[model samples]
Target: MRGDTSNYRDLFLGDVPMMDARAPIEFRKGAFPHTVNLPLMTDSERQKVGTCYTQQGEAAAIALGHRLVSGQVKAERLAAWADFARAHPDGYLYCFRGGLRSQIVQTWLREEAGIAYPRVIGGYKALRGFLLDTLDRALAECGFVVLGGMTGTGKTDVLAQLAHGLDLEGHAHHRGSSFGKRVTGQPAQIDFENGLAVDILKKRHAGHAHFVVEDEGQAIGACSVPVGLHQGMQRYPLVWLEDSFENRVRRILRDYVVNLGAEFVAEHGHEQGQLLFAQRLRQSLDKIQKRLGGLRHQQLAAIMDAALAEQARGGGVEGHRAWIEALLTSYYDPMYRHQRESKAGRIVFSGDEAAVLEYLRRASTMARRPDPGTSA
Candidate 1:
């Protein structure tokens, strides 16, 4: 079954949810969208089984697993899985390699739970492989337009306006910045790649010649963009997003301060939440201290603290503009400029947000038109 794993790739194309039969630790590391964790074994149980297999042998491991999972513990797990299967009739189950773990899940689901749960042929490993291969194919078949801009230029907005735009930051959920951490943390690396690959596959399957994506560094938060896609981005035509510094600052205020503050308050109480938001921003800025140099870092840190203090006293969060503006000018702008220098001669055009959106929409329509070979 593992050898015939091609069918696993198309699972995401429909509304089929996934039931991850791997342990919670494994699922937490990375997972597909619409996946619910229905672990076959607890982490300790898996560890015990692994240790038994290593020290005793496969038969001993099997016996030990049977012993460990019997009675109440076994019944509870089976009940949970049956409940999930009943709800998601079309869902597939998967483990690490579509090996014994997944097979056992399928058998037990049928025999014990009276439910026939179809397991992925090669499990998560095969599905992930398919997505990775799909990404490579997509890059080869499709042309690309790279969106370039400094932080706060609202590049994400441009991507939204464009028909074929791909928001890498949105996929990663980190905004591709030190301070880009969301109230909800970023997805695991494996999940991030799968998400991106699905998008690419959809685009490629639609026969689009190319798509637009942001120019991001390899890493976003804890997740890294797949190497091949990143390379394609480097080689693609670039469109620079230009916005005024003041407008950018206001955008930042709206996002990082106003929007984020409300979310934090909703989660935590008002006072603690504001402090955490302020601290998070400060921590993000502190990460670039070496690049900022000692003096500039100190100056900015002071401004940042004052802004936070003012907010603590119920002053407007717009005071953060002082810190944000300074950080942009001193750190982000120069860093972008250096990177741009490296990207010299690569930029195909530069325009404000509206112009770029208009360009991207037209480009998307052109890209979607029938190819000469396929033309009637």
Candidate 2:
């Protein structure tokens, strides 16, 4: 009781490290940020115990779990937990609901290891609940503004500069497009939600009463915005980010070509990375083939093939511009134009990147100001 805590707010805000004690399967479904899975039971062990519980009751299940985990297995788990405890003395531990498994873990540490590590009061469920509530409350109590633009107008760049900016794409680890997939995979859906909520919580704690987010749809890559936040975003005021078509093309080439190629090479060795990067580009284009239409898609694909080949030979990246220009002109721009038109009523400002960043920062400052009509 002395070390156990229910204070989810400080736990997240302080970036407290935590050890999760749920089974591996449960841990995979969702987890808090900065928390590691040092599961109480492996998937196979958990399944056996679960079956025992369903057929023979709690006493039998407990017996089965002990039998499955005793001796060397138990020693190894205890060592892993002890190592973590020694490494992070202030960290907390938890299971699904701070129930039997975590209680048992706490008891073992105290009795066998002589370490009194704290456990979260309501465990993973409560922490997750706090985050969901954090996001919902922020949507209700805080003012939010959406930054809208065609592809590569650099909405993300502007958001990075604002104090209250929420980079949903950053949280999602995506650029929010067909070509947005990173070499690394996206987080699980629950992890995405938890990350977003934690972000809002920390900002609110820092006294931000408003936020800026990109004009993203329901989904960015494999991650979806929470339903309530997405709905609330639709009604928020919008800022349209603009840039010259040539500049946009150049940006796309730099991001998707030069930079992405470098990322691949850095991740894999040069030969494999270059091969995968080329494949990724072609595959991404193929995914939109129906939308691009047969003739246009083939023409673009040919240009892309030529560009990839040229770059492979150590030619400069200028060749990428041809297909990028064509794709923007034929595909992305028209789609974004329709989206902006539909949401025209919400457009509160429009400008190039510098002007838009200035406007958002100014607006954030105004929002943080106290009302003159209120008492001092």
| Top candidate when judged by lDDT against the true structure | 2
What is candidate 1's lDDT per residue for 1-376, written digit by digit as tens? 1222337546766646878899899998888878899888899999999999999999999999889888998899889889998898877888998888778878898898878778788788887777777777667767789999878889988888665777888898887777788887778888888888777665555556679999888998888888888888888989898999998998888888888878788888888888788778788888878888999989999998998888888757867889889888878898898988888789888889888887877787777845322110
For each candidate, give its TM-score against the true structure.
Answer: 0.91, 0.96
Name the lDDT value of residue 143 in candidate 1: 77
TM-score of 1: 0.91
Candidate 2 per-residue C-alpha lDDT over 1-376 given as tens digits, one digit per residue, 9 for 90 to 100: 3579998888998999999999887888889899999988999999999999999999999999989888999999999999999999989999999999999999999999999999999988898888877877777778999999999898888889888999998999888888888888888899999998888887777677878999888999999988988998889999999999888887888888888888889999899999999999999999899999999999999999999999999857899999998899889999999999999999999999999989998888787733211111
Least accurate 10 contiguous residues by lDDT in model 2: 367-376
Q: What are the lDDT figures for the candidates, one per model?
A: 0.81, 0.89
Error (Å) of candidate 1 at residue 292 is: 1.7
- For model 2 the local lDDT of residue 312 reads 93
Give all candidate RMSDs, comma-separated. Answer: 3.4, 2.9
lDDT of 2: 0.89
Measured by TM-score, the strongest candidate is 2
- Stretches of candidate 1 off by over 4 Å are 1-6, 369-376
